[model samples]
Target: MKFWRWLVILALYAVPVAVFFTVGVVVVWRSGRCWWLWWLAPLCWIAAYLLTRTWRKQLAPPAETGFVSPGHWTPRDGEAWHVVESHRRHVEDIAPGQLTDPHFYLQSAMDLALAVARHYHPKAKDPIGSLTVLDLLAAAQLAIEDSAQWCRQYVPASHLLTVDQWRTLGKTPAWLSAASNVTWAATVLMNPLNFGRYLIARFTTQAATQQLREHALGWFYLYFVSQVGFYLIEMNSGRLRGGAARYRRLQADLQRTADPPVGNEATSAAVTPEPPAEPLAVRIALVGQVKAGKSSLVNALLGRQQAAVDVLPQTKQVQQYELRVNATEDRLVLLDTAGYSDAGATPEQMREMQEAVRGADLVLLVMDAASPARRADVKLLGELSAWLEANLHRKPAPVLGVLTHLDQLRPTLEWTPPYAWREPSRPKEHNIAAAVAYTRQQFGTQLAEVVPVCTDVARGRAWGAYEELLPAMLGVLGEARACALLRTLHAELDAHRVQVLFQQLGRASTGLLRAGLAKLLDAPT
Candidate 1:
């Protein structure tokens, strides 16, 4: 779309140059006004040059806002501007695969978790003493290492891995475990003097309280600083490799089309036809059961009060919300379907609903967290998965299970081994622990991340839990992957245009050079 727009602009500017040159040549040849007509050539050239420069400037990608230029390359400001602008564009149109890059979101979440740990457990120096802090650092480091491996394996010299793969690989429990160990080791090994001081304070001068505070602060500084450095290294590595890979792939794609022209009846007929117009955008449908808090979750994800809710099933039909991420303008077509129950839905209606779920890029299997193992929720999950396998077996989209209504979960329910969901008044620590264990077990291994959300809309507090989970969701969809996908799409569109130009040139009687020149002049600017 942008390329064609630029082509049209360039062609319009070249019109005067073409007309002036033709007129000047005719005047010199027919009227023998050589000197006067020769002057027009330079004038036409200057006009065309100026017009082309102006058009190029207009077509160039816009400069990035709020980026500080680093003085590494010559023309530092220009390079910085271009790099930032290109990255901005890439982010805007990231391919579905790139968004899944585990490193990007995994690192981000790790960074945030580390920040929290540093604040809360500043003095602890080992995983046993400060488990949360150790987990944060370990997770961040592991994510970086895993991401590096992914960069080496799948990221071609020209392109980054697709978002889906990135997310899938990043979320693996093995990666998280490795990261946890790294954090644990770092806390134990670094700055022994600080630990000694903390111990001495504990034993002597009755200043134990003050010494403990100092130790905590010192540990926090060390851990926080390391995390910052790790982020810098990881982000830089991704950018450098990603850029090089994209450039190389672009070259390869271009090279494949550099073959000599073929002239034959069969060859002419062998050309691939143009692709049908793309749907305005991808459409997604959301379906689940009644009192499932589907509407609340939809509102939270969309960041808008678009869906209505009641204690009873307020959503009766397929309600759709077109959602875009705040940071990245990636469109999500959310379809909220009528909640299923044994009583209300007919077989035909059930089949149609199942079809919608199967077609979704992702299905949000919403269930009440307070009632995690309800028969209806389990039935719905089974039905949805069955439909997808039976109908759309070739291309299966991921189903993201969502557990909602956490506030209602009995605070007193004790979580025992072989965890099961139970309702108790004034839930204790055991209950919370058991609930977590049970939820993980029920979901099985393929579950991306089970989110516990509060479904009350008036409070607007339930949505807070989603803040951390949203990035994971976006990662699954490969938000960054969209950039590469768009670039490929653009390249294909240009190749199509070039093929059309070649066909037009073949029909011309003039020499190839003259035809080329005419086509260039007539081509849309």
Candidate 2:
């Protein structure tokens, strides 16, 4: 059955090719030109096809979810991004033979992997030596899983292929390779001139084809190596797994004192000072349009009228206030930002807002229900969203929409407490619900939730400040904590990366010098 299938395939393709060759030869003979020249067109066509084809298929990053990473397992450090990008540029420059040949490919891959490992683990010449058997096995398992995922996505129904079908498919490549060798030998032996032309064409075509294959494999290894490098860095930093334990260990290390020098009892007094063990404080920024009752909300949250409340926008700068939890050190820092105008804020005001948002772990976007025009607020939200996207390595600060002036929504005479906006029965409640819905719809998924709040501090009739909004803020506390942790980690890394790198280099140079001096002393005259 296989023999018959092969015969049919050859006949189907060979007949047309033979007919075209014969017709070309006849035409060339009639024109009194060399019939061999007729093959040039086909050779050029093959070369063009090989050169024009798109070979490299893009591979996505490994699909491992970070239990602690704020932004859905994406790399949280600039160093990780740097290593991946650098490796990609280096890998793509790999020679065609190195990428296509198995032995060369493996050698090149190992060399690149070591380069990445060295960048992350600079103390060790061979970073893999530090990894245990389980670590190595885990890496292999991850690679296997990524391979399976690639097959499932790119190879379509790969799992459904029978063992016999797979074997037959595998043999197809060997048969095609043998046929190519036979064709090459036959063409070379035909005539000396033909052989020269054949060799030129074969070289051109094969070079193009090999380059395409090189690009395809280059792309595959580029993504694979990048993912491996990213995880490697994360693992080394103790951020990937056992993060809490690692954090504790880091704290312990920081608190630990160095041993005293031998025979120097006085040196024992000189110990490392323990860093202040302050709990992570969640920073919340109240941002909205001018006269959106942000100041009132701040006053209510703080249980005092500390923020100046006036008819005009009094808060010209960011005013930070601490919301301390009673009987505990756990506290939240509230940033009351200057509001944007209906037309929008000035560049300076926007800059201030951006700085406030950058430092915030959570944002409370105060929206006035009475004011239907929220274009300015929407623009601010859009800008913030873009900023967050640009900085995905940082943990995202969750935004919650606070629909303020619920009492001012409908029924001018009514001042209600405890309005059931979720399942509204009264007209005022319904209007409040509609306002919340409108806010949510306008913002889309930008807001985690919209809570209807009435921050009427001047009237002394504040509602939803403690009931709805506070609880909503506490609800996303876990997410906010993750963001805080990531924020602290990146900050610490940025501050110490250069210092640590210099220290390592200093130690390495000193050790190398010591070894050289020792060798010189031991040398015979």
lDDT string for model 2 (1-525, tens) is: 124433443353355467658776457547645665546544654545443343222221222322232232333454455655665666645665665566864665466556656655567577576554444554555566667898899995698998899879979978987897787687567544456655655665555555545655765666566666655655544343333344445434323212211221122233523323675677899988888889899988889889887766645579989986432233589999988888987898899999999988889988888888988988988887788777655656889998887767669678867888889998998898888888888989889999888878677668998788877776675566556666666677568768977998999999999999999999998
User: Per-residue lDDT for 81 in model 2?
Assistant: 51
- List the RMSD of every prediction in angstroms: 31.1, 17.4
Kindly report which residue stretches of model 1 are placed more than 4 angstroms away from their true locations once superposed: 1-284, 311-316, 342-349, 391-393, 412-433, 479-525
TM-score of each: 0.35, 0.52
Error of 2 at 330 (Å): 3.6
Best by TM-score: 2
- Candidate that would win on lDDT: 2
- Which whole-number lDDT from 0 to 100 does residue 103 have in model 2? 81
Q: lDDT of each model, Cα atoms only?
A: 0.48, 0.67
Return the lDDT, model 2, position 502: 100
In model 1, what lDDT does residue 520 have? 98
